[model samples]
Target: MSGTIAFGLFAVVFVTSALSGVFGMAGGLILLWFLLLALPATTAIVVHGVIQLCANGSRAWFSRHYIDWRIVAFIASGGALAALGLALIDYTPNTAVVSLLIGLMPVLVWIPKAWFRFDASRPHHALSCGVVAGGLTIAAGVSGPTIDLFFIRTQMDRRQVVATKAAVQVISHSIKIVFYLHAALVLSKGQWGMVLLAIPFAILGTRSGNAILRRLTDANFRYWTRWIVTAIGVFYFLQGLWMVT
Candidate 1:
């Protein structure tokens, strides 16, 4: 990448990581879109996985006290199993199809709550959500919206939601990296350096977002998160449509 493109990647990682640290979602999807603009689809997916691993890992660590370990354990277990299965199959979807699914994901929130009455507090529900989200993550490069469904009915507060979800994503992203190891191997030294360069910015962004997250009321946080995610969804939807056309 040129200096200009590298700088742009760093800026997007910083801003989106901060957004994720505050909202518990949306940032990864936006980051993926920016990365796809700069890299091949497979390379973008692998790079996005690493950047998010750092971003969410930092967020989970910083908010360690609030993380729901039980939920994380259940989700991680299911996600890991699902991911392992996916890796064995070694299936890769068409980039346009993946983009379209990701574009449509956020709109799932609009579905009536009554249609899916399962409580996220149940261990089985968490595991099931993990399986589905994990599979989708491998295929689509971002499954934050699917994961959000598992938590929507839970009694967690804003901080708990962010912390727990970040922890769960840590597992998902790690699995993605494993599945994408071939792509990682093909990266040039400078590209590897670029990955390293993005980590600190991700950490900084997470910390900054966490600081802001502390000041928001739960209602306001949810309100803002919904709109931001919806806006991102629309952007991805258009991009995907244009690509297919």
Candidate 2:
């Protein structure tokens, strides 16, 4: 690869990982975009999942004390089912379809809360939520908001909320990586360099984001996450359109 491409990938790793920690969702859509520019779409998905599993897994582990085990178990179960289904399917939708769906999610999640003043709190059904999160995650790589919306309205405290989300994501992402490997989506030894090169930047970004979050009030974090999600959704939407054209 050219020097420019390598540098660009490194930059993306740093910025997206940092953003992920502060925002509660890891940067799958963004990461996928960068990887697509460098590799085939299928290979890009594999690389993205593998890198994210390593990077975000560390972040979640560092915050393991904050994790909710029950949530993790439920989400993992569902995500595994989704992964299996996706693996079995012969034909899947194109990137544009996935991107557009991802773009719509932020608005779908926020409009009810912001305009209707709706509190979507209902009883937690782990199996049901897990299935949805897993299926969408496999299809679009942007299920964080779905999972977030479910938990945020549950009257959970800030730390527990973040922790639970992290835990669920860890399990979900881990399953994705495993399934991808089994499906032959992951790269072999030749591609390991790029993946390894991304690690330091991701680590640095995670630390920086965590430091910033420490000072923010709960209300501030909420407002920040909502706006960021909206911006990210628009990003995916526009990128999807560009990809198709």
Candidate 3:
């Protein structure tokens, strides 16, 4: 990447990291879109995995007091199995398909809550979501909306929701990085350095976002988060259609 592009990406990371810090999801999807403009799909996925691993890790840590360890454990167990299964596969999905699925993810919230009544408090439900979310994150490069869906029916407050989701993403993204590395997706020294540089910005963004998050009422937060994610999902759907066409 050129110096100009690298600097631009740094700015993007800072801004998006803050967004994710507040919303718990949208930033990664937005970042992946920008990355696809500059890197091959496989390379973008690997780099995204690394960047998000750090971003979500920091978010989880910052909100560690609110994290639900039981949820994380259940999800991690299923995610580990999913990652191993994906690693054994010789084939990956085409980018268009993954993009389409991502596009449709946010809209899932519009479905009637009664239609999908998995109690997130149950370990089985969390494990099932983890398995599906793990596979989707590997294939699509972002699956935040899907993960968010699992928590919708839970009794968690906003802080707990964000913290727990961040923890689950940490596990998912870590598995993604390992699977890509196993698949021989090597980054250039410059790319690796860029990823490292992005981490601090991501951390800063998360901190700023958390500060902002503290001010929002739960109702307003949910309202804004849904719309923002929905808008991004539409963009992803259109982008996927354009790619396939």
Q: Please, what are the lDDT tens digits per residue for candidate 3 over residues 53-94?
A: 888999999999999999999988888877777878854756
**Which digits, one per residue and each the tens of the lDDT, describe model 2 over residues 1-245?**
66677788889988888777676674655777678676655556566776676667767766778777776776677778777777888435457777887887787557565553322233246666777787776666558777776776666665666667766776776665565554343456646676788888877876676667677788887777778787878988898888788
lDDT of each: 0.86, 0.69, 0.85
Which ranges of candidate 2 are over 4 A from the true structure?
Answer: 91-93, 113-124, 182-188
Which runs in model 3 stand beyond 4 Å of their true positions?
182-185
C-alpha lDDT (0 to 100) for residue 113 of candidate 2? 53
Tell me, by TM-score, which candidate is best: 1
User: TM-score per candidate, in order?
Assistant: 0.96, 0.86, 0.95
Candidate 2, residue 25: lDDT: 72
Count of backbone collisions within predicted model 2: 0
Specify the highest-lDDT model's number: 1
lDDT assessment of candidate 1: 0.86
- Root-mean-square deviation of every model: 1.3, 2.9, 1.4
* Order of models, best lDDT first: 1, 3, 2
Residue pairs in collision within model 3: none
